[model samples]
Target: MDEWFRSWGLLRDERQRTVFRRTDHTHLAAVCWPSCDADTLYDLARLAAVLMARDHEIDTAPPEQSISMARAFRSEVSARYGLGGGTGADPRWTPVFSELWHSLSTRRSPRFMDRCLATAPTEFLTGCLVYRRRSGNATEADELTAYFSTRRVTVAQRIDHLLAEASLGIELDDEVLGDPLMSRLLDLDVDRTILIQDILSAPRELAAGESENIVAVLSAALGCTTPRALEEATVLYENLTDTYEQALTALLGSPSGRDHDVRAFASALNDFSTGLIEWTSHSVRYTQAETSNWTKPDEIVARGR
Candidate 1:
């Protein structure tokens, strides 16, 4: 992974290299993208970097400059990739993107890529089929699940895993395990994650003067104190977890062959959801980086256990 960044010109210097190393994306990718082979991970890492360049607000640049940079980046990326029309992106992107685009086009046709870019672009770019979005912010849980599934991840490796394990056909392209019961299982899987992330990242986000978090949002919506909000959120997490386990139990206890494919897919999804919780619990991505010296990757990065 570090070699990819180094050779692709993404992490050009020692500081950037150090930061990339400490980020420890490899662990998370391995966990969440449970079905990814070496080639798939390579694609995921490369495209994830491109996506984060303008999407993730990592820099403390002034709002205006940041917006300007994002617009230029989007435009440049669109123009270069032929996603749509735009001009005058950062010149540095040209070489890196050209190589990426070349390799991508060699594997897949431009028209197919355009279609991929049009829908669930992140899944295609990242080459992971574990479908999710951090969109559990809703007054009700079921509503959030249905709403979020509309914009689900649509990559292919999860398909690969399912096909390999359950011997499923391409007819089941949709990632919901194709039923309401399976849908609820996934909703619970993601729901606890948002709650956990809300609790964990709330400190850093509050320090940065942000409150688009479950703890803060729930506090405001429920008219409760912060402690009450945290408590309620923890209860909700436990409840969701219990229900999800029950759902898994119900599925796994079936007589035989009733929902085998869905069960197999659910296992992979469990790996993804639970793996994310473990990885983030160990990583400092959501935590304040002040305590640890990030210059040392081994000290800071939460390696796979």
Candidate 2:
């Protein structure tokens, strides 16, 4: 471990070095590789090594073991940070957990995945901190009472930070948390029914030529007539469009029709869009193009010759 720390030290940013030396599992998880922080560190190390090789005129093999150690350290950090203390009865935390699960299951981008993986530590630490702060006078029977409280501002701030990190193209281990919109939604209080309703009413952009495919798929799965499937498909399509529009409106200031139940609307739209992508793929077509016999059959018109 000492040797490993020394190797990490050689790449020294003082904060990073401190993060390494303290061996705080939460901090380690926050900066682990493939996560944005890790990717940043990796790039910095590579650049430093390049300069050293060029200027110092020294030949050095890449520190493969050190890289591996960093990853291992990150894993340990996540485990420690995510334990969430001994109590598991926080009602406030329940919705957060649900959002986390939803983000994990729905979003599939590589960037999103990395963020999700990286979030283990942050979520765990935050949950524990909230629990400790709010659950001071809890009794056995009252264990079911709300033991966690998160201000909307704090949640929003964290979500913004994560989104900024993701937007900068930082590689994260879990793609779900890396998804900009999903991350934003997860930060909100799920009990805010009005917010939820608004989110679902937003518009989405179907990937090129994906609407037809999605329609066909739903038609098969629901075992409905083509007309009925088409109607349902249109509804689904509009919902998906609304989701993207809403997300874009929220994140990028695109205009959207105001929604009454923003949060549920957003959550439902996100969920459906996510499901549509998972169900439709490049290979899901119902028909294949017949191969053409363009090779000039045998002697290519000996009659013409």
Name the top lDDT candidate. Answer: 1
Each prediction's Cα RMSD? 8.0, 21.3
Model 2 spans > 4 angstroms off: 1-168, 171-223, 253-305
Q: Worst 10-residue stretch by lDDT in candidate 2?
A: 278-287
Worst 10-residue lDDT window, candidate 1: 127-136
* Model 2 TM-score on a 0 to 1 scale: 0.22
Q: What is the TM-score of each candidate against the true structure?
A: 0.61, 0.22
lDDT of 2: 0.33
What lDDT score goes with residue 1 in model 2?
A: 33
Per-residue C-alpha lDDT of model 1 across residues 36-56, encoded as one tens digit per residue: 667555655565555544344
Candidate 2 per-residue C-alpha lDDT over 1-305 given as tens digits, one digit per residue, 9 for 90 to 100: 32332443343366534433333222212222112344443332332222222211111223343333333333433532233442223332323333333343343454454444456334533443343333233321111112113322212233333433442443233343345655554443221221222222111211222221333334456776546755765664466456645554674331222322333234333332232222111111111212111212233223112
